[model samples]
Target: MSEKLRVGFIGAGLMGHGMAKNLVERGFPLTVMGNRNRQPIDHLVSLGATEAKTARAVAEASDIVFLCLPNSAVVDKVVLGPDGIAEGAHDGLIVADSTTADPTETKRIGAALAEKGVAMLDTPLTMTPKEAEAGTLNVLVGGLAEVLERARPAIACFGRNIFHVGPLGAAHSLKLINNFMSMSMVALFSEAVVTARKAGVSVDGLHELISAGALNNPLFQKVMDWPLKGDASGLQFAIENALKDVSYYNRVAADAGATAPIGATVQQIYALANAQGEGKTHVPKLMDVLGRLNGL
Candidate 1:
């Protein structure tokens, strides 16, 4: 097993497919496990990656492994369960997880893997699937200095601006803070647009005016463009993950003895949107929910 830093990807979703392709194209011997969604897995395999039958096979075949999962629960099962990576990974193997998760769970995973002679690095990513496909995702990392240095090259394939934020759980902490603000903005923007429409302003005009001046951002552009173009792919991001981040963000804020009323309110809004069966649509689809409520 003296291979040249072979890599394995445990998830091949919207983000993982591109990241794995980038690694394979760059000549890293890559292995990827097939997920329930076969398209991305097939795409990665076409790029010359070996397909592993299970997470353990991926662990047995690589010196470095990356997990781009949905949340801490999936991450826990893949890394700590019976046939998990930790169960098969050899000494000095590095497992880097790019999932947004609870800080305590991250710390617990780190400690458990450390006992197995494998180090766990939490390097949560930020941005949309488009950014991920473009290899411009931002990475906020937390880990030992040595492990971070060793993982930097593979991480570079997918992340444009990578930062070693701090140690252990710092990256997840910062990621929670960042998404709190992001989800809060979604709630605020949806309310503003729907309320403006009720007051006789067109949604397009509102987006144009605000986006041209002070209230514009990448988030604003993406959300406004999606529904405005009449494209509801249900892929922009879901209310479920949004609410998950909100819950983690609120918990983080509370533990620090700080209060964020706006974020709290937005969490409830997303919860309401999920209750209305819009949980699987883009977060911007909340505009429709708000629209009906405002009688627009």
Candidate 2:
């Protein structure tokens, strides 16, 4: 690694674009892989970041590679598939995954990378693309302490609050738990608002009470207010993605011989929404799905 770490970023989607931009702007030598969407990749290229044709190419050219991909499945394919990161990784290369992923799968990937002398860290992010653009995202990291320090500078390019939660898979586990809490709240709030609306209570009134109470939170506000204004893109997280996180959380609980009845119910709620053709809808649009379910 050079004095300024050579960084490669994969998945230049909504969140990845902003994160990569911050790293490049902060003076890291960045190489980014092209994505299906060229806009972000082109933007980064114009900002002095190099473009690579494949994940392997990116990994070959950088000391540390960052992944802001969509899910664990994609992460798996990108890191282990033929011509993937594992193929090009060198000793001392660090792969920092900022995706909310399955902890078990993350561990497997980490162990595989370890065999190649490539360190893998689960550094899942919180907040949204807006926060990513503002360089104020929260990063929950899981890996060895020394490895966390090695990646901290690049992580800090986009994360205002960085927590080293545990080792190997702990950050991803904590992310699932965090998403379970957040998405469950959205599910409960969705059902409550619909029930209240059917009983002639204004959603605004419900919002006021919750906003003034101990339950007030940024998720509650965005989930409630976004749809009220007929804009579901405020959260920028898909219902399907929320369902995936909750499902992973339930699996994590079950594997640990614990119960997750609430998580199960929340997963079902998002499953129902996804089944009703709202999978691609923003998570905040759960309100709309619940509304349609009750014939509102």
Candidate 3:
């Protein structure tokens, strides 16, 4: 709180905008790179955050750069490609990523950044974008203790429950696992809903019974939001993203010599939804997707 760090942010998408907004409101000097979307970029600039032409420019003006991009490929390109953050890397600079990404890729990127004296932390996040906008996303930090301590102040501006998991890549590994479980729950609830309807049981009855039983979960309520209340705002994740994370979990498990039968099945389910052209549809709408599948 005493000394505000200069912060640079890339990927001003769903989760990034809120995280970047909090950084500026919390008083860190902010520099931001423009992404495909201009609304969040303009909004951040309107709040007194400086806009940079490229990731390199953002990095040049920052002591710490945070990336909240969608995937590993884009994150890698922004940090390591032409006119990217690597071009502007300096000694003692730090980069933290909140993208749900591959652990192997995260480690490789961190190692590459280390050679340039830029410490990297994989700080994958939990909670929704609503929570992100509220500055309360739970931060699963994966990096050196000393580096995290140095970067804690700025991270504290947006995180609620921040905890160190391990060295670089650990947080990402955990994130993939966490996402897989949550997305699988979405699929499970969707099937249960359709099955309830097909068997002459109302979704309302199913929801009421589950609400009082061990099958109840926050996600169960969210998925039920669609059938019971026609509200998809409860879980805003895209079906495409669900497939991505589930597939990533399977790959991570294979790399570790572990089998993931559940992850494999979940991957195919989301793939089916995506093939049905519901890729961009949010998770709560999975109820509809499965409902149609069951002819209900």
Global CA lDDT computed for model 2: 0.91
Locate the minimum summed-lDDT window of 10 residues in model 1: 226-235
Model 1 clash count equals 0
Model 1 spans > 4 angstroms off:
1-3, 232-235
**Displacement of the residue 151 alpha carbon in candidate 1, Å:** 0.6
Sort the predicted structures by TM-score, highest score first.
3, 2, 1
Q: Which stretches of candidate 2 lie over 4 Å from their true place?
A: none
lDDT per residue (tens digit) for residues 197-295 in model 3: 899987788889999999998888888888877899888899999998998899899999998899999999999999999999998887788888788
lDDT of 2 by residue, 1-296 (tens): 34988999998898888999999999999999997799999999999999998889999999899998888999999999988999998988999999889999999999999999999999999888998998999999999999988888888999999998999999999999999998888888888888998999888888889899998987888887664677666678899999999999998999899988999889999999999999998888787898898999
Residues forming the 10-long window of minimal summed lDDT in candidate 3:
287-296
Q: Pull out the clashing pairs in model 3.
A: none
- Point out the higher-scoring one by TM-score: 1 or 2: 2
Off-target runs (Cα >4 Å) in candidate 3 are: none
lDDT string for model 1 (86-159, tens) is 87879888999888888878999989989989988898898767777878899999999889888888899889
